[model samples]
Target chain A: MSMPENEIREIEAFLFLEARLADESRYDEWEALWTEDALYWVPRRADLDPAKEVSHIYDNRQRIGTRIRQLKSGFRYSQTPASPMRRVLSNIEIAPAGADEYEAGANFMLMELAIQSTRNMNFWGGRTLYRLRRVDGGLRMVVKKILLIDADEPIANLSFLI
Target chain B: MGMQRTIVYDALVHRDRVHGSLYTDPGVFSDEMDRIFHKGWSFVGHTSEVPNIGDFKRRQIGLQPVIITRNPDNEVRLLFNRCTHRGNMICAKESGNTATFVCPYHGWTFGVGGEMRGVPLQNGMGKDFDKSAMGLANVPRMRIYRGFIFASLAAEGPSFDAYLGKARKLLDRACDMSPDGEVDLSAGWLKHRFHANWKMLPENNTDGYHVNVAHASLMRAVNAFSSQAFDEDKGDNSVTRDWGGGHTELDFAARYHQTGRPFQWFGGVPAAKMPDYVARMEQAYGKDLAQQHMIEGPPHAILFPNLFLAELNISFLIPISANEVVQYYTPLLLKGAPEVNARALRQTEGAMGPGSFLLPEDACMAERNQLGLAAQSPEWLDLRRGLEREYMDEKTGLLSSAVSDEITNRSFWKEYLQLMSSFPGAAA
Candidate 1:
């Protein structure tokens, strides 16, 4: 069944804002949007069991906290001079929800320009699955799982959050 | 400022430094591919990759691609992917199984054993033409230690055993850690590219000097999220060794497994599951040995020139050119322990996957190193840190040093120099 129009629009706006927070390197604001027990996963391959097969990023809230902490440390050489990125989110679909949780899926295209001794731009497209819960009449993400089109291929860097 | 194309071993390689051209010159990369890679026993893939009959996978040793397969007869064979007719690649798929590989170009078919089976319209060739004479060319030497398969392009060199030497013990240890004394590579792999010379990676794998500075971001993140999970002040005592013949290891398991606290990398397995995991280990091995295994950290084993088996994964390094390399990271699965295997996969994902925090940093450093090598003023890359602290074993000629010592790189260069200099007057 299709999502209600209002829910779809709300989810789209939330995802867009989430992308904006990361694109602007507003890490602290981005971190706050996640629930206490959040899960963020990026599978290395489209057909992989994160528990059995390896993932690009299979993180708990603590791990996400660690990642943000590292990125903020100004020593993550890969992102020391942080790559500038813009993510375009589209095709938002809100799946059925539990008592308070709504599952939202969206397609994203992230364009990143990285300058590390040389200038290179990468266009990464993927489908992101997010689990959002109603918190104080707004929404907070409990899980975000990203599956990239070229997940199995070798990439130079994915230093920035996608 | 003119620099000679020929690499003079004595001038280019020293106790502490190596010439910058070794990282930049395309001619040197070609020579090394022929001399070092072709002659040396480079690892291609594991037997586990093609476990069943008719299973096959394509792998590379330097620039040459070969198909690693287990035929219907259950014999593992390495067949050149190149078709005999017009030198076109016979198979394009990275991995799969077929009783016969048909060249799409001409429908020329070859068996899994690499024998020429059928040629489309054989009547076109002269009556004297023989199909028996034409078959896929096999690599000169193929050997498997435990499950790791290594092949040599040149016909003669050191025996695989002799070449492995002390490195063999570590490989055995890696497998022995598995409850059933077996490891499988069926899980699949992660591939990442770096704009750096191939040598930089093997060196980085064994170098402890970069851990503090290069991986500081990782350390800080882990510490911040997990109550100082990677705080340096905790006094992690690890050691690195040059296990003769260019093989090396950084043994750091003991430090992490101290007091049985769950490591930050594995996330926090439930406190109750910790004992159960130990019990599973004890079931496979006796109480004493299981405890020893638990206490000892897995050594990151780097076999000479190409392959590295470390912490539940194997990395195969393929060089595309002087300034480019591809790293294939394959996770190792323990035969019967689903929980341990899952944890291992999670830990590998957290640390080394393409989007993970650690590898990208290393790639940046390697790429920058490549760029810096272009400068003419600093003619040498230094490997001089902690040289005096190394101790040599008189019997095996293996050298041991602190985990952060430069002895690892020095030993690597020593072997590299010997191999490079073995070429008579100049590199062809």
Candidate 2:
């Protein structure tokens, strides 16, 4: 069955709002975007499913909450110099899974600038598969899986949310 | 008679600022290749990687490329990857299993053990061409300690065990965690390159002071979970522990301890199940050792030069250029572990994999450090934390530290200078 246009728009808005929250460093709000049983998954390999394959970031809601709290705490050394990031998300697609659950996909690019230097641009565009359910008449994510194109590539510290 | 300046072998003897050339100089790096990488026992790989006969893996020892293979006899051999006939690379792939390596350049083939097996045009060459003498050049020496393999390019140095010293316990503990007393390289590997000096990473890997500040995002994320699990007083005492040499442990302050933050970060275990896993670990390793492992947290031990042995996995940092480094990361799985346990371990590895939330923070920090250091201004990077408390232990050949000490950096610089100053012949 096709998802209603209004429902699709809600999913798109949720994705845009979530990305904005992360880019703005509003981690607490970003954490709130997920359900209590929500999962944040970034796979290591393109072929591996988050449910079956190992993922780079397979945090439950509790872990995600901790991550947000850590960002809020001033003790985090990597965050001391505050990495500023700008995210461009586009090509949103929404598909229905169940009566209230819908899967959403989008392409995104995150450009980070730190105190030390400029032009340290890291470009990554991936399909984010989100399992969304209508909660309190509003959509909340149950699982957000980010499958990066260069998922297997060695990476530096991924301090910020993508 | 004129007096001469005394030569110091110890890395700690230098008092004031080290020369800037040490960081930017090419000649100094070459010298490091000879004195440190070539002379010392550098980790090649684990024996489990090439468990079966004819299994082989290609690796780099400093700038020299080598192929480590297991022959039909189940003997592991480390040989230069170059073909004997025309210097063409024998094994181009990163890793594989093969009965023999055939050079594409001249079709000269060598056995898995690097023995010259055949030449395409055998009669074309006069009978005097000694095939045995023309076989692939073997690394100077290869040795294994509890399945971890190491190869030295130089013929002489302190034995691998003596060099590892107190750090052997870390390896021992890692291997002993498995019921079978061995660990194997599981699945594939993750490779990344950084536009930074390779030396900086080892120093940073063992640097505990940077954790609270450099990894604030990760710590904060982990800490949020901790705040609910434990009280304030328990969190305050969490500090970095020094394990002599350049090895340092970032002890999750007590508040985070209940959440098993260290295991969550290094072991990649889930926060929810940490308590159970810790209990299981305690039962396996006994209470005392488990306490030592847990309370001390995971030690990001830099085995001098460019190897970091963390609880989660093994990583080798190879200097590709003056300002570029290629890092190879592989997950370490306990041998003979149950499928469920292995799956859990692999899950943990995946959580902290290359695309992991934790790694991006680390990579960003490293890249930023490189960019910051590239500036023209002579800004002094601080290594003074707990400086007053740092003392050289006569027994372990390490600079000891309490919480948040920069002794790991100090020890690294100490070794760095020694490696930089010593000539190739001197190291030999």
Candidate 3:
């Protein structure tokens, strides 16, 4: 049976809002959308185990908090002249993962314009797999795995979150 | 009646400043590739990368394509990836296991040990063609020290030990930190590039003066993010040492931090897991050794020309041109300790990843520096911080300077001046 329209709409709204919050740099709101114990990972290479290989980002809640704090505290040199970003998330697919948990996969393309003393414009496209848990009748992200198309290539500074 | 002689690279470098053209000139970049990268012993890949027989890992050394493979006798061999037939690249895969690499162009195959084994059409070359005589050209010199592999293209040069000199101790310390007496490099790599001369990276590695300005934001954020207190200004608590042969080290304070743990950032590993991890380390290395390992912080060691070891990661620079360089950052794992390895991998990603907070700022600074070098107004870049405070060691013939000093850069330039002055192309 096909998923109900309401459920699909709910998933779409949730994903879009999450992307909007990140792009808008509303870090506190973004943090609130995550479950207490969350695993956020951006792999260096596709299909590599985090335990065996390295990742671009592999932060639990505390590590995530650290990154957020860095961004928010105005002390992150890379983000001093924080990049203005716009994220386009599409091709979203959602399905039940476990009890009260849903798995969502989506493709995203983010354009960021960073202006420090100089201006650097960056474009990044990636696919994201998110495991979201239903808490208090609302969906909260448990894990976010971002897989960039050119993970193995020698990329420039990706200071901003993808 | 005194005769005067001119040294080729003497004018390029000065006591406290170097010519800006040295950073932006393409001719200078090419000369560097030939004189420094090609002639010197540059790090290739580790032995653990191809542990099993017939396994191969591809590497490029100053435009020369090389393949590191495990031979049938279980020995490591470095071979040129070029095919003898048409010079097509033999192995394109970054890394894999295969007994024979068949050239797609003409079906010529070579063994993992670098011997030409088979040809699709044998009759074409005639029976007089010597199969055994034609094999892949081997790199002139290949040396393995503590599982780290370094390759030299020059036929004659100083021995690897002579080249390493006091820098060998840094490698030993990194290896000894592990209970197994060896470090594992099986973890994959993080590749990045910045718009600056490749030399800027090594200089930046030991350049403590820029910390407060270039990385002020990162330090401030890290301090604010963590519950633990930190002395962000680490200059007073550290020392920069020059170990000759362009090798230098930044030994930061171990007081505000613990070593051998991989992750130094506050809130790095879970608090409850710290004791258990320490217990595991103590169980494996005994109490005293483990204690020493924990207290003795990891030194940021930069081997002349290319290799750099920072904490649990070994990053090497491949100079593409005057303004572009590719960096391969491989996070090393402790062999026996899974927890430590896991932590190392995570922390390495956070520290060196493309999206890392620290390196991005450094990259921006490098790009800015490169752009600033183009300005003819300021013809020199200063390296004169704490120059007068440097003290030479009589025994090892090394130099030590304050942590905030640019002595590392000065020492590196000293070796650079020597090599570049003696360079064949420079003399020509």
The candidate maximizing lDDT is 1
lDDT of 3 by residue, B287-374 (tens): 8877666556345889988888876788988888898888888787766667677677777877785677678777777778887887
List all candidate RMSDs to the true structure. Answer: 3.3, 6.2, 4.3
Interface RMSD of candidate 2, in Å, is: 4.0
In model 1, where do residues sit more than 4 Å from their true spots?
A1-4, A91-104, B1-5, B224-237, B253-277, B393-397, B424-428
Q: Any residue pairs clashing in model 1, and if so which?
A: B253-B297, B254-B297
DockQ of each: 0.69, 0.31, 0.60
Quote the positional error of residue B223 for candidate 3 in Å.
Answer: 3.1
The C-alpha stretches of model 3 lying farther than 4 A from their native spots are A117-120, B1-7, B224-235, B253-290, B393-397
Question: What are the per-residue Cα lDDT tens digits for candidate 2 across B1-428?
Answer: 85533333333235334433445556656656766778766777888779889999988888899998998888999999999877898899878899999999889989999999889879988989888987888998898888878888977766776667677776876676564567776555666666666777776676655555555455445543333221223344443445544445443434346554344444444535546556566677787776656444434577766667765567778777656777766655655444424454444544344444344455556666667666746645556666776666565454555545666676667556655455444422
How far off is residue B184 in model 2, in Å?
A: 3.5
At residue B244, candidate 1 shows an lDDT of: 80
Collision pairs in model 3:
A75-B217
